[model samples]
Target: MIVADLSSRELRRRLSDDGLYLHSGPFICRIQSVLAKVADGLALAYADYPLADADYADFHLRLAAPRLRRWISPQVQFHADVRQPFLPLPQQQAYAMFEWGLNWCVSQHANQYLILHAAVLEKNGRALVLPGHSGAGKSTLCAGLVYGGGWRLLSDELTLIRPADGLIQALPRPVSLKNASIEVIKQLAPGAIFTPTVMDTSKGSVAHAKPPSDSIVRQQECARLAWVAFPRYRAGAALNTQTVSVPQLLMRLAEQAFNYSLHGQDGFSTLLNWAQSAQAFEFEYSDLPQAIAYFEQLASQPHTQLQHEAAPV
Candidate 1:
């Protein structure tokens, strides 16, 4: 059964008591919380995700609302396997904290694959990996591609690469948008569904866009890496795609990778193979619609020998 099979009351009850175990592509996470907003957020953002059976889980997580803190200023703390791993957030930011906390847990501990701080999306059988620094509009660009550009979402934060085969492991989850990107996506994709916006977090007014139901249903499907684009959002800049050398892509990807060194030769070999097989580019844009159009064209065009400089650091 999926999350939509449960009523809001049932979901809340499950989260408050026995916990809600749900499938997130390759991993199963059991989330427990007393915060009502958490239930609301999950129902909106994860309604398409399957409910995992009680027998197994990769992560056991909880959001605790301490009575003392509630009496004082009202806060929520994130716990992993009964140990608090993060500071308490304002009670209103419980759902955002849960989302961010879960990402932290996976990125820090899941070393079976080479994890990159990036977003991955697919069209046909090829994946487009967006690796960018904070405030680089990676998530924003990803949400647009998924909802408006007819691509499937593989992941919004973590790009898991299987070193053995150089395939992207899908982990379709809600796309987290910060500050202005939330409304930017709303305007770009009118049908996009989002959780309630939480204000004044470390990321500044964070919100989450629900992944397309098609993406969630097909989350188990993996794809070969086809393109790696480092996106930058500059005000009023025209859409531009610059060819990047394989060495440049490797260095940049290593900087953003979570487990590059941990995988040793496997990581090096996989990245080298990936660079050989996939095209790399540095993408900068200001207009969302034009950017979407450019990517669509890029995906459809035939691959050619790139004659250009290395990408910017």
Candidate 2:
């Protein structure tokens, strides 16, 4: 049964009791949390995700109040299969912490695939991978594309690429918007659901936008890589898409990968395969509408011979 089948109260009860096993893309995360915000967050953001049976779970996690911290200040600790990996965070930020913690759990432990620090979305079966560091506006642009351009969301944080086939595995999770970007996206997509803002975290004023229900419903769909765009958000900058060489793209992508060296030669081969098959560009833009329009044009263009031609290593 899907999470939507359960009432928020039922979801909370399950979390407090035996835990709630919810499907997230290919993995089932069994969550047990006594913190109310954690339940609220899941109820609001993951209401549409499928709830798995207890017999099948990839990871079991919990968010609970800390012991000593209860006397000093209230805080929450995240536990994966009863093992706590993170220090306690403020009680007010429990939901944000849970979301970040889950992403960390999957990205760090799921080494079966070549994971990259990127935002991925698809349109007409063509997937675009946007890789960037913090403050790069990758999630902002991804939210814009999914809501503003009607692209399907594959993932807003981690991009999982299978080395064997070089196809991107879907992880249609929430889009995180930090600080000013939260308000920016709220205005851009008025209908989108956003968690209440939590201020003064490491990322500063963090909020998560729920992934579109259609994207979550089609989470099993995987697509081949089409374009690798390094997006930079600069104030008042005109829209520019610069062609990046394959070697440079590969080097930059390696720098942003989560487990490039973990897979060794297999990882290198996967990167090579993606670079050879997908177009690469450095995208800089100030105007969100203009940026969306530019991508629309790119998405409409058919794959060309250049996509398959090998570049100098």
Per-residue lDDT of model 2, residues 1-313, tens digit only:
8888898789989999999998899999989988899988888899889888888788888899987788787999888886788888999899998888889889889999899999999998999999998888798899999988999999998999988889999999888899998988899889999888999998889999888999999999998888999999999999988998877887888888999999998998889877777789989988998889989988899877464455444
Q: What is the lDDT of residue 275 in candidate 2?
A: 75
The clash numbers for all candidates, in the given order, read 0, 0
lDDT of each: 0.89, 0.89
Candidate 2: where is the Cα deviation over 4 Å?
Answer: 307-313
Per-prediction TM-score: 0.95, 0.97
Candidate 1, TM-score vs. the true structure?
Answer: 0.95
Per-residue CA lDDT of model 1 for 1-313, tens digit only, reads 9999999889999999989999998999999998888889999999999999976889999988988877878999898886777888899999998998899889988899899999999987778999999989898899889988999999989999988888999999899999898999999889999999999998899899999999999999998888999999999998888988888887888888998999987898788777766788999999888889988988887756444454332
Q: In candidate 2, how many clashes are counted?
A: 0
Model 2: which residue pairs collide?
none
Q: Provide the lowest-lDDT 10-residue window in model 1.
A: 304-313
CA RMSD, predictions in order = 3.0, 1.4
Off by over 4 Å in 1: 302-313
